[model samples]
Target chain A: MTDIATRATRVVAATGGRRRLNGGGPRAGTIAAFLIPFFLPFVLFYLVPIGYALWQSFLVVRRTGGQYGTSYTTFGGFEQYVQVFQNNEFWSSIGRIGLFGIVQVPVMLFVALIMALLLDTPLLKIKSFFRITAFMPYAVPGVIAAIMWSFLYSPQLSPLIDLLNGIGLHPDFLGPGAVLWSAANVSTWLWTGYNMLIMFSALQAIPQELYEAAKLDGASNWAIAWKIKVPIIAPSIILTTVFSIIGTLQLYAEPAVLRQISSNISSTFTPNMLAYAVASGNNYQQAAAISVVIALITFVLSFGFMRLTSKRAGL
Target chain B: MSNQTLIRESRVSRTVVMALMFVLAIYFLLPIYFLIVAATKPQGDLASTNGLAFSHFQLFKNLGTLFSQSNGIFLQWALNSVIYAVLGAVVGTLLSALCGYALAKFTFRGREFLFSVILGGVLVPTTALALPLFLLFSATGIVNTYLAVFLPSIVSPFGVYLARIFAAAAVPEEILESARLDGAGEFRTFFSVAIKLMAPSLVTIFLFQFVAIWNNFFLPMVMLQKESLFPITLGLYEWNGQTSRVPLLQESVITGSLVSIVPVIIVFILLQRFWRTGLAAGSLK
Candidate 1:
C-alpha cells in the first residue's frame, strides 16, 4: 500500500514537474485546444453581441437631417430609456401580454397536468401512441404551427369561419375584438402538449409505492392525483409555468404571422414588436432602450417567481 | 358492499377519463386535419367545399401545381431547412459533447465559472439578442448569408447544460481514468468510451437543436435578404404576404405548409425511440 501510494505521488509529481516545464498532461492542452475552437465562435457571436446590446441600451442616437437623409448626430444618455418608460405603446403591449398570461397560463397548465395524470394512470391503453400524438406538435416548427393555425383562423379558409358563415353569422376571427383570443388559442394548441410531456415525465418519476400506500388507505384516484401526485410534480409544473410566462412576454412569431392575415395588430402589438418598429423606424436609441427594459423585466419576473416557489417548496 | 361501491366509483371515473381523452385527441388532431383538407383544394374549391370534408382529394394535383408554379422555390426552401437542421444538429451536438465531457470529467480551473455562465445564458431570451446579432452580422458583412443563421445556432447554452448533466450521469470517471492510464489520449478517451456512454443524450440534444434551428424565423427574417436563401419558414411568409396580389400563391402556401411538416414528422417518428429512452433514463436520476 505504501509503495502504491508513493508511486501515485511520484506520478503526480512527475506530471506536475512536466507541466511546470512544458505543460500538464495532454488533457490540459487537448481540452484547451478543443474548447477554444468551439468557444471562440460563441464568444464572438453570442457573447459580444449580448454585450453590445447592453452597451447600446445605455446610449441613444440623434438624427440631424429630414426623413430623406439623416446622419447620426449625438448620444443621449438615459433619455431614450425615459422615452421607453413614458411610451403608452410599450405599456399597452406589456398589459396585453399580461392579460395573455393571466388567461393562458392556468388553462394550458391545467390541461397539461390533467393529460399527464391520465397518462400516468396504469389503466390507460396505448400510452405510447397517445404520448406520440400529444408530443408530436412540439416537433412542429413554431413558424409552421403559427402559419397552420393562422390559416385555420383566416377569414378566407377557416373552418370555424365557414361554419359560422354557414350558420349565417360571419364572426371575424381576425377582428380586433376576437384576435387576441384567436392568437391565444393558437399558442395553447402548439404548447399544451409540450408542457404535458414535461409534466408526464415528472409524474412518471414518482415511485409506485406511494400510490400503493395511498390505495391501501382507500384513496380515490382524484385524491391520489391531488394530494400525492400534484405536490410531487409541483416543481415541474412551476418550471413549465415560468417557461410559459417568459414565452408569452417575448411573443412575436404568432402575432407577426397573424398580422399578415389581419389588420388588427399594430406597430406596438407586443413589446418585441414595438422594439422592431422603433428600430425599423430609425428610432434606434429608443428601440435599444425598450429592448433593455423588456429584458430586465423578463429577468426579474422569471427569477423572482423561481425564487419564491423554490423557497415555498423548501428546496 | 364497500368493495362494490369502490369499484363503481372507479368505473365511472374511468369512463369520464376516457371521454376526456377522446375529446383531447380530437383537439390535437384538429388543425392537422384542417391542413390536409386545405392542401387538397385548389384556390376556387377552397371556399366552396365544406372545410372539413374531402373535396375530390386533389392532393397530388395541388402538390404538383405548388411545385410547378413558383420555379420550385418550395423545393429549395425544403432543401435549405434540411441542410440547416442536419448540419447544425451534427456540429452542435459534437461540440456540446466535447464541452460537456470536459466539464463533467475534468477538474479544471474556471470550470464552475464557465458552467454557471452557460446556465445563466440559457435563460437569456433569444429576442433580446436578435437585434444585436443583426447589427453584428451587418457589421461583419455576413448578413443575408447562411452563416448568419448557422453560426449563432452552433453554440446552444441549453445544449451544453443538458450535455453536461448527461455526461456526468452516464460516463463513469473511473473508465476515463483507466483509459488515460492505458495511454489512450484524452480526445481518444472522449471519443471512445465517453461518447458511447453519452450517445443517447447527444441524440436528444441534436433533435432539440434541430427543431429549434428549423423553426427559427425571427433571426432569418432579420438576417437574410436574398430570396433563394430563404428557409421554408421565411419562404412561407413571403408567399403568405403576396397571396392577396396573386391568389395562386395562396394555394402554393398551403401546399408548402403541408410539405414543410413532412420532414419534421419524419424526424420525430424516427428519433422517438432514443427520445423516449433518453427521457425515461433522465427522469430516473
Candidate 2:
C-alpha cells in the first residue's frame, strides 16, 4: 500500500528524478518530433494569444474622425490599464465576484468537507448511490445547470416560489439583491460533489491504523472526524478551496445564462463577462487590459493560497 | 451501564448522520429531478403545473420538436459538440501522450523548463484567452468556422501534465532499454509497448478533455456566430434566451438541456472508476 501510495504521488507530482542515460538517451531530433505536435498548437493557441493580449493591452484604439471611421491600434503606454482602473463597472464586477467568492467558496467547501466526512464514515448506507447523486452535477455543464436553476428560481414557473408563498414568506431568487447568491447557488450545486469526491479520495488514502488507534482510545466518530481526519485531509481541503477560488473568479456562464431570464443580472455581472462585453462593444484594448488584470489576479490568488497553505502546513 | 449508554449514544449519532446524508442526497438530486420532470411536460403545462410533478408526457413530442425545429439545428448542435469533443480528445490525447512520454523517459536539455512552461499554461485561464483568440481567428478569417473552437480545444496543457505523470508512473526504463536493444525505432517502441502500458491513463485524459470541450461555452460564444456551428450548451442557451419571445421554445430548451446532459451523465456513472482514479491521482499531486 505504501509503495502504491508513493508511486501515485510520483505520478501526480510529475517531478520524479530524471532518468540518467549512458549515451544521453534519445536524440534531440526525436524528442522534438514527439513534442512538436503538442507545442505547435500550444504556441499557436495558448502562448501566442497570451503575448498578443499583453501587446494589445498596451495599444490604444484610435478612431479617425468620421462616420465609418478607420480604427488602428497604436502603442499608448499604460493608457488602457488606466482606463480599466477608472472603469467603475470593471471594479464593481470584480467586487461582486469578490463578495461571491468570500461567501460562496467557504460555504461550498464546508459542505463538501462534511459530505466527504459523512461518506468516509460507516454510518452511511448505500454509499455509492449517495456518492453518484452528489457527483452527478459535475457532469452537467454550467449553462444547463444555470438553465435548470433559472426555471426553479422563476417566480412565474417555480413551485418553490409557490411553496414559499404558501408559507406567507415571499422569495425572490432573481431580485437584484438576491441574483448574485442565486448564481452562487448554481456554482455550489455544480461543484460541491466534485470537491467532496476529492476530499473523500484523500480520506480513503489515510491508513486504517490511523483510525484504529483513535477508536481504541474511545474517540467518538465526531471527535475522530473533526480532530484526526480533518487535519490529515487539510491539503485536500486547501486544494479544493484554491480551485473554487479560481472558478469563482471566472464566473461567466451561470450569470450569463441567468441574464437571459433576469433583467436584474447586468451584462457585466462578472469580470469575464465584463471583458466580453467590452470586447463586443469594439473596445478591444480595454478588454485586453481587463483580461490581463483578471489573469494576474487569478495567478496571485491561486499561488498565494498555495504558498500560504504550504507555509501553514510546514509550521 | 456506562458501556450500554455509550452504545446507545453512538446509535443516536449514527441516525443523525444517516438523516443528514439522506437530506443531502435529495438536495443534490433535486434540480436534476426538476429538470427531468420539467422536460416531460408540454408547453402549457410547464407554466401551469407543479414543477416537481409531471403534467402530460410530452418528452417524445418535445424531443421531436427540438430536433425538427430550426431545420433540425439541435441535431447539428449535438453533432457539433460530439465532433468537437471526440476529435479534440483523440488528437489531444495522442499529442499529450507523445510529449509526456518524451518528458518522462528521455534525457534531454531544457525538458524541465518546457514542462514548467506547460504547467504555467495550466494556470492561465482559458476564459482570459477567448477574446484574444477571437481577434486572432478573425484576422485569419476563421472566426465563425469549426476550426476556431477545434484548434484551441485540442491544446490541453492539463492533458499533457496528466500524460507526463502517467508516463512516469506506468512506463518502466528496463522495457524501453530492452526494446531499444531489439532494434526497434523510438516511435515503434512507443507505439508497440509504451502505449499499451499507458492505455488506461490515456482514457482518463480523453475523458477529461472530452468533458472540458463538451462543457465549453465561452470560446464558442465568442467565436461562432452561425447557429449550426453552436455546441449544445451554446445552442440551448440561445434557445433559452428566446423563450420569452416564443414561450413554446421553453419546453424544447428544457428537453434539449436534458437531452444534452444525458449522455455525459451516463458516461460519468458507467466509467466512474476511471474518474475516481483520475481525481485521486490529481489531488495527491
Candidate 3:
C-alpha cells in the first residue's frame, strides 16, 4: 500500500511539471501578436527602405569585365561623392537657395511678427475676420498657391500687368532677374499667414493681466510689443525661423511647377531639383550622395541656428 | 466722454477698420477669385478677358470637358490622392495614437530612449530620407507601388511625438490604473477608456496627416512613375506642362485646381473646432 501511494505522488508531481511548462511563456512572444499589425508594415516600408538607400548610396553600378555583357564593376570608392561635389550646376543651385534663405527667412518672420502684433491690438475690431482672412492662404495647398501666383505673375493673366499697362509700363515679372523675387513673393504670400497664425497663437497666450498692468503703467503699444510680447514669444519665433530655413533648403514643388510655365528655371534650379535631375539622368549614386550632403547641411544649419539664437536670447 | 461723441468716434473708426479689412480680404482672396474666374472663361476668354472678371461662367461645360479629357485621368489622379491621403492619415494616426498611449501610460524598458529617438526624427526632414527610402524599397522590389509612398508616410515621427505629448496631457495615469484594477485588459482599456480621452488629439493628428499627405508632391513624384498614380499636385503640373501645347487643358487644369481646394475647404470647416483649439494648445506648449 505505501509503495502504491508513493508512485501516485510521483505521478502527480510529473503532471504539475508539465502544466508549468505550458502555462506561462515569454511576454515577447505573446505581445508579438498584438504588435505585428502595427510594426510589420512600418518596418517593411520605412526602416528597410531607408536602410537600402544608405547601402545603395555607397555602391557603384559598374558594367563588369572584358566580356560584352558581364562586366559588373567595383565600389570605385567615393567617386560618386566626388562627382556630386564637383557638379557645377548642383553647387550653383545650392548657392542660389542659400541666397534665397538669406532673403526669405527674415522677411517672412518679420512680417508674421508685425501681423501678429497688429492683430493683438486692443483697438482692433472684427478680429476674427482679419485672422481668418490672414490665415486663409494656409488652407490652399502650396502647389495650388504656386500655380495661382504664376497666373497673377503672368503677362497674359495678371491684372496687375493690366493696371501697369494702363499706366504705360509693361514691367517684366517672369524675367530672369525678377523671377527669383517673384518666386519668393509666392512663398511669402502662402506662408506669412501660416507663420502669423503660429505667432498669433503664442501672442494670445500671454496673460491679459500683464497687458492690463502694462496699460496702467502707461506703456505704449510699441513698447509693450517690443519689450514684453516679443521677448516672451522668442522661442516661438525661433521655432518658426528654423522651420522656414529647413523648408527653403528643401524647396522643390514650387520650383518644379514654375519650371513648366517659365523657361528660365532649368532642370537644376534648386538643390532638390538638381538631385532629381541627376537621378533622372541615371546617376542615382551621385544623386544619393548629393541628397545625403544636403540633408546633413540642412540639419546642421537648423540646429546650429536654434542654438546660436537661443544663446543670444539667454535662454 | 459724452455718449454722442463716443458713438461718433466709434462709427468713424469702424468704417476705417472695415475699409482696411476689405483691402486685406481682397489681397487674400484674389487667387481663388482669379482661379474661379479663369475656370469659368473659355480658353480664348482666359487670354483676352480680365483675369478677375466672370465671362459667362462656363461651370458645367468645364466640368464636362475636364472629366471627358484623357479618359477622365484627372478623376483617376484625384482618386489616387484621396486613397493615399485617407489611408496614410488613418493608418498613421492610429499607430501614432497607440504608440503614444503606450509610452504615456506604460512603464517599460527603453521607453525614454524610444521617445527621444522619435523626437530626433521630428527634426529630420522627409526629403532628407526620401533618397535612402527609395533605394531601400527598390532593393526589396516594392518601388513604384502605392505601398512605397503610403508606407513611409505612415511613420511620421512628428505625429508620434505630438501623440505622446497629447496623450500625457489628455489621459491621466490614475484612470488607466483604475481600468486595470477593474480587470479590463490593456487592449480593452486603451480602446475604450484611453481612446475616448484622446479623441481631440487624435482628430488633430488625423487632420495634420490628411493635409500633409494631400499637399505632398515630392514623395509621389519620386516613388511613382505611372501617370495613373500621380496625386493632383503632380497631375496638375503635368497637365499644365501640356497646356502650353494643348490649350484646352488650361480650362481643365484651372477647373481641377479650383475643385481640388473644395475637399480641403470642407475639411477645414468641419474640423475647424478641433484644429483651432489644437493649434492654440500646441503653440502654448
Q: Which structure among the candidates has the greatest lDDT?
A: 2
Better of 1 and 3 by DockQ: 1
lDDT ranking, high to low: 2, 1, 3
lDDT of 1 by residue, A175-243 (tens): 998888888887888889878887888887778998998899878788999999998888888778878
The DockQ ranking, best first, is 2, 1, 3
lDDT of 1 by residue, B80-137 (tens): 8888778988998888778877777665556778888877776777887788888888
Where in model 1 is the C-alpha error above 4 Å? Answer: A1-27, A63-70, A164-170, B277-285
Residues A48-120 of candidate 2: C-alpha lDDT, one tens digit per residue: 9899999999999788977689987799999999999999999999999999999999999999999899899
Best by TM-score: 2
Q: Is the docking of candidate 1 incorrect, acceptable, medium or high quality?
A: medium
Prediction 1 TM-score vs. true: 0.93
Per-residue lDDT over A183-211 for candidate 3, one digit per residue giving the tens place of the 0 to 100 score = 88778877887788778888888888888
Under the 3 Å rule for N, CA and C atoms, how many clashes does model 1 have? 1
Clashing pairs in 2: none
Off by over 4 Å in 3: A1-50, A62-73, B1-24, B281-285
